[model samples]
Target: MLSADRMRAHLDNARRHLDTARSHTGRVATATGTAAATTGLFTTAVMGESLLATLAATGLGLLVLPTHKARQPEPEKVIERTADGGMLVYTPPAPPSHQGRTAAVLYATPGVGLVGVLIAEWIVPGFHWGEALAVALWSAGTWLLRPARRARHMLVPPLPPVEKVHDLVVQDEPQLYAHPAAQWWAERVAIEGGAAPATVLEDVEKTGESAMRAIIRASIPGEPVPDISVRRLSALMDVPQDLITVGPVPGRGASVQLLTVGQADAAALDPARLWAERIAPLAMPGATITAINLGSMNLSKEDA
Candidate 1:
């Protein structure tokens, strides 16, 4: 079976290849269109028409040259091993998007065509159909080469006003944030588990195939967060107490983080043994252990 790292590597390589192919394809289209237009210009019998067509084709070629857009690198977060033999997964918030810049480019692209038309008129005194056609083709090619913006819909749309919601809407997918379980779990923990009233789920960080880290925050102003025990957290998370570790988030006073190993790991460890061996070491060393792929740590009785 292929590992997650290998799969990610393969996907990245494929994306690079696709980007190269897209660049080549755009260049080829521009070259072919410009060449065909130029050839027709020379073949025309009328001297005046041929001159106009030749000038138009030259202008089209210059305008149609592919523009390279520099891609921004994505921000990456890491799970670091703290000196106290614990893992701290810190994921910074995503940066603002470049949609505004993209919109500006979209709006400015048509100006290139306008500029071509103005230059063509300067070269050939009167307005000609040949120049108009070249401008239109250049504009079309520019729009076609660029990727179109897609309209996005929320996976779970916001609730309407209290009077409008006649029916109940349920969200699924317990393991991830794309559904209701993550939010529900946090709310339940806050409301029923006697955490803070303003507590909310910050993020769900997956450590490996065998474990995940859930970050919950209590948002009461000017008040210190109450200590939440592992027993209560385990009950809220629906896992064995031994499989869960509750810790305070450094620098974030009202926030707490919980690490929960999978049930398979539970069978391998005698209550709390898994934490000392796999995760606790991260806290004790103080060194950042960046690469961790704990794939199914189900061992036999002798191995345990």
Candidate 2:
């Protein structure tokens, strides 16, 4: 039996899948129309060719066109709670690369036949029934040869033994934040930064106060307190005015970290608020937001 939360999550995932399918259907419809138009033009240009011959040529083209093999159905993987109170998800390894080689060889037969026919017409003195039969046999033989060629190349090549290392190198790097919360925050900030500075500046001046006030007023269910900064907190909570600081809490960790502090009007804040509302549900659960600091740190290194 599935938990209520798990069932709801599954339904949400289904809805997302349906939306994606609708989007794809629209694209497929456009592609089909374009392909029909192109084919009609091609038919007009080749008006003298017999319909049967044209179809044969098209069939041969389809067979010869280089395409990756039909993808194998992935094994169904189930996620379940383990005895250790952790989630366990089964992930299957990828299918072997050469699994479809035989199928590819079989499909190449018509292309080989078309080539053989062309060759016979050029080489033979006259187009005759015997010549046609010879071409057909040659084509079949060519198609059968492909699988043998693939098999011959299947042996794994031996690797060279490694020699002693000449140099040792070590570099210290900051550990990157991999959590979805960090990624979402970074992406949101990047998008906001990409907007016209003049427009953002205007917004910073106009709606900054109202947005900040709104953030403080909005109720978030899980947070310990309304702890937030003017910049990030405002953005997260959809507050307009740029947040400068907050009332100090007893423990330093209890207070929200201030990410930014700057002048922002209520107007500029509206867009950020709208963006926050759009992405809030998708953010990592239990993640806290800080204000955006627009100090020297926010400036590009090149500009600095």
Candidate 3:
């Protein structure tokens, strides 16, 4: 029977073998694609072997090219001397950093295509400057296609109005100026644990027969924004003075408008009730009536 350590070692070795096999497969696919795309780049008929070698090298080079990986702080290690002159290693365990907001991105080297070109020049016989150029072209193509981290756009369809909404005079009703831009750090955070992969918010346009003009585009900032700031914004939903908007008031109705640009990341704030809570304060004081679905407000110009 194998010990647990031996079993674990076997598993690790298997994983490494699988990884190498996968790497080889990807290189083959990449080389094939390059051959197809670069057929026009070089005179294949004149330099068959050299061109094939160039393409192969270029494809394989891309996967191996080194790029910057997100660096993490190494665990602090302490060495203690024992009574028998033996040294014991101790690693101070610490809680993982609350990186809920930090976004993760897979960065690629832009010039690696050129690296592939150089590699092909060295390995393939009869390789010429033209073939080198093809390698560079293939490298650039691979670099562009490599998947990496990106910002997350948080905008869901305009959510239903917040709870406890009461009809208020249209003139007295204040327009909810867009929340000051927040740097949705979630976009840059690693795209794992069900987190979003991108950010997509835009200006809220004028909709419906109402007279309200476009006030402003509400979006989180590009920089990592603190949750405290967003939480404060949510809290202010109850403050009448903080309410800001523009344009003449439209006809009054029993329904409350929860405006949203319908972007992808819009739902991110739903768990925190950022929109509904904000609308609650602007309703008639002490009046707990607000319309959840006041018919659809067409966001498109053709609906007008």
Candidate 4:
């Protein structure tokens, strides 16, 4: 299998090639149009060749273009060293990133431009040059106008009512908050686990009471601690509070909560662990990770 670093380098090279091709195709189209107009023979074989060549160049340029991919951390691998110091294996996380809409725009722009040029060159035989220029100007004007209108609509969506329930969760507990469970649980876990107790405590205080309550609730399912904030997990999970109670069990003569779960879970609950696991790995000797392919099947197959 190709390494992540190798894959990234390959994609970068592909992007550069596509960019260069696009530039060359644009130049070809401009030169072809000017030549056809000055020569006054749009129906000739030479004109057809120029038009087709421009389209083919633009198509090839679009075909090789690279799209942006999101970077996702690999799955946690709990490696156990053998006598020879070789490590045991575990499954990695699946890739998470995808191409954005800009890629579609990039692909469509050249294709559409090619079609327009071809139609203009072939259908009109001897249409006035001014009419062709006017059509191009009007199309450009419409494209520019639509995006501006869309931007205005996005800028002013309707706001929710003030009375509606809204919650904000943090990694730490909050002050002036009614939920004692969040504060108690966070401090207890940090102290018992010998995790950074001071930092954990400080996070709880900064997150606010509402956010802390939501974190506690989400962390421990079926444990209704209090009436808090948002309904969606995306909002609830983001509570800045780092501590999460994975489960509760009787330990050391009391019902103590299990603070840590799997390695991935631990990383999610603790910022230090997360940074160490995800970012620190990149610093390791020969450690290089690449994003999964974001292009279409044909591109992926070609790369393979």
Q: How well does each candidate superpose onto the true structure, as a TM-score?
A: 0.26, 0.19, 0.21, 0.26
lDDT, candidate 2, residue 178? Answer: 52
Worst 10-residue lDDT window, candidate 2: 195-204
- By lDDT, the best candidate is 1
lDDT of each: 0.52, 0.41, 0.39, 0.43
Candidate 2 residue lDDT tens string, 180-262 = 43433434532334211111111111234432211111122333333333455455646455344444322223212223344
Sort all candidates by lDDT, best to worst: 1, 4, 2, 3
- Tell me model 4's lDDT, rounded to 2 decimals: 0.43
Output the lDDT of residue 6, model 1: 93
Tell me the number of clashing residue pairs for each predicted model: 9, 30, 32, 14
User: After superposition on all CA atoms, what RMSD does each candidate show versus the true structure?
Assistant: 30.8, 27.2, 28.4, 33.5
Q: Give per-residue CA lDDT, model 3, range 209-293, as digits (tens).
A: 3221121121334432111222232343332322323221122221211222222243444423433433344443344433445
Q: Candidate 4, which segments miss by more than 4 Å at Cα?
A: 1-43, 68-101, 129-131, 134-304
